[model samples]
Target: MPKSIVVPEGTSKPIAPFSPGTLADGVVYVSGTLPFDRNNDVVHVGDAAAQTRHVLETIKTVIETAGGSMEDVTMNHIFLTDWANYAAVNSVYAEYFPGDKPARYCILCGLVKPEALIEIATVAHIGRP
Candidate 1:
């Protein structure tokens, strides 16, 4: 089967040259998603917890739209600019995927938007067309 791109309708628009997620061979490879709102504005600019929640929700929307769920996520790639916000980010993340968590790797990195405190990308096992 040919690979297909999944662009979530209600999530923030991509500010770069990448799709929200790419579906190929029953897997959805999500790009690094920034904490932007529907208007493409940075959300909760300085608040890591709030920004973390927003980004996760946005990722959820994209995964669900492509016929998957948080439970279907095989891996999550979490990116952050500062290590100081680690605890806060993890707190919010725990609330979202409390059980059967996916494999993940968290790393400190520089993001495109300076105001973005957290960015999350994922790989989900989508089982539908």
Candidate 2:
């Protein structure tokens, strides 16, 4: 059986009923991350591009905390409140994964939180040492 572990960072607390990140077998799965800042506040209020950046940055930090880097990411699932914001989200996303981008899926959906225009979840592999 694979053991499951949670990602740890003492700076901010999780406000929802979810683990920040989980380790199972040799892979790390990070939960859908919102555009919350270090203080756990939604930082990007008016811009979808800014919100996308925040979501990606948060996912990157969670992956790194699990001993993985953005380069190690296998897949990403992106959720946007509106499809019209695709270009804006894509532009910001390209900045983070500059080369060898991971496979990704983008979907337009109604968000649980109104101010959040974007959310990103990631899967990464921490290969055997």
- Please report the candidate that would top TM-score against the real structure: 1
Q: Estimate, for each residue in 1-36, the C-alpha lDDT of model 1 and write its tens digit.
A: 899888877655567788988998889998888888
- Once fitted onto the true fold, the runs of candidate 1 whose alpha carbons sit more than 4 angstroms away are none
Residue 69 of model 1: what lDDT?
86
lDDT for 12 (candidate 1)? 53
- If scored against the real structure, what TM-score would every candidate get? 0.92, 0.89
Each candidate: what lDDT? 0.88, 0.83
lDDT of 2 at 27: 86
The superposed Cα distance between candidate 1 and the true structure at residue 21, in angstroms, equals 1.0
- Clashing residue pairs in all predictions, respectively, total 0, 0
Q: Give the alpha carbon lDDT tens digit for every residue of 44-111 in model 2.
A: 68799989887887788777877778889989999988888899999998998899999999998877
